[model samples]
Target: MRFKLSTVVLPSVLLLGSACIVEAPGGTSPEQRRAATVTQIPPLSVRNGANLGRKVELVAATVQPGRLTPGERATVTVYFKVLEALEEDYLIFVHVEDVGGRMERMNVDHKPAGGLLPTSQWKPGETVKDEFSIYIPSNESPKALNIWLGLWDPRTDSRLALTNPDQVRNDGRNRILLAQVPVAQ
Candidate 1:
């Protein structure tokens, strides 16, 4: 039994190509994400809270180094409480924007807990603490920066509604205003 070169090589090539095409959630390749560490802790009082639809509440959001400067690193930690179980897994979009909120500098968009525990997996009454870091580019002007976050279904391109519109400030795109860090001039 002799195997033709075309048959052997074609199958091998096809397998190799397919293996390289794996897609992570939101159509991003795996190499695009930074490692994330998320922890679960007992429920606490919400220092700053906003309701995302009726299923989840953004309990609190805090930024370290309270201020920022060009080429500096800042860490953002957010807390959430599941108000109700969700059926669809949603991605969290964390946006760093200019002071005026007219332009976006960068976005740290990823699945909850780095995809280890998605929104669909969250249970009612559970408190989730997620932390991630971002670098302030040196090219940005010495102006305050705003950090915004929200949940969205990447497939449908729709964001979860921010129920407390009166209490929370949004970008008109449903993104909650998480924090504002003053940049050293």
Candidate 2:
């Protein structure tokens, strides 16, 4: 079978081009990107919404299994919807702590999408779904676990403020408590 040169070369070029991360032509700012009309914002799968800094909203968070046990793993998924433009990328932190937030049991912190997608690149109304896994330490006490998360600037270690401070439980440190799960005895 003979393949046309144009067909073979075109596919190769398209694949190579798609791999590149390019800024918007003309250096469009996040505001400009948001100004451009998008048909619709994608619907969120989870409904636990919390506003953060009036820029980003935590659309929802989920912990698999709903209960925790020492020496086991649980998947934590967080959904963030961009409400306004952001000029800098922020790191996401997921912390598993004792019921009273007195002790941290585990911390799963990383850049969104493993550093592939940054907050600065997010457009208004765009939702980002990030997932990470947490392993409970075997030595941890059999108590309830409070799952908390927030976006923070790594350089300054400043966290985004929780806009709806009264809606959910928040530690003075800017950590928004997402859920509480009982540790199986």
Candidate 3:
């Protein structure tokens, strides 16, 4: 019996071609691969006032390796300033998101700017240095990580001009600052 080339070799060639495609280890599908890639990045770190807006300005950011256990965690430090002095109350948001869609919020103090700068009312000439330490999980699959910082203006009872269009607008709203940091292992 003679074997036809089309019938015998075609299927073998196709099977070998498909096998050459690399797949992620441990049953990670294509979608999971893409998601993993997105999560490997570290959080953003701003270094200058130019990256900030009128309301909340980014002074600087720093990070250090905290623990190297099952899940990697890094202590992130950030500095910011609030322009203009207002009697209204405000809240700052700092957070980190991992590749697996896990997010963690950083603890920050918005009162008595002692560790920061300019404890009194936010003045034009005065500068504030607010710091926050954030932890990033090690199970993040070594992908891109996202970090965000926002300023919420709770001055509903008072009428004060809020700076930073991205954080707050003239319509009496709030705004936030965004930063992207790349991570590698």
Listed in order, each prediction's TM-score against the native is: 0.72, 0.71, 0.45
Runs in model 1 deviating more than 4 A are: 1-46, 100-104
Clash count, one per candidate: 0, 0, 22
lDDT of each: 0.61, 0.61, 0.36
State the lDDT of candidate 1 residue by residue for 1-185, as single tens digits: 11111111000000000001222455323333222223443243225567998888887665555556677676666778888998887888777777675445677776675454667767787776666676666666546666678998999998999887666666666787665556766
Total clashes for model 2: 0
45, model 1: CA deviation in Å? 9.6
Error of 1 at 171 (Å): 2.7
lDDT of 3 by residue, 99-161 (tens): 346444333423222212222234443334443344444454434444444544444432222
Q: Which ten residues in a row have the lowest lDDT in candidate 1?
A: 9-18
Clashing pairs in 1: none
Give the lDDT of residue 33 in candidate 1.
27
Q: Which stretches of candidate 2 lie over 4 Å from their true place?
A: 1-46, 100-105
Error of 1 at 142 (Å): 3.3
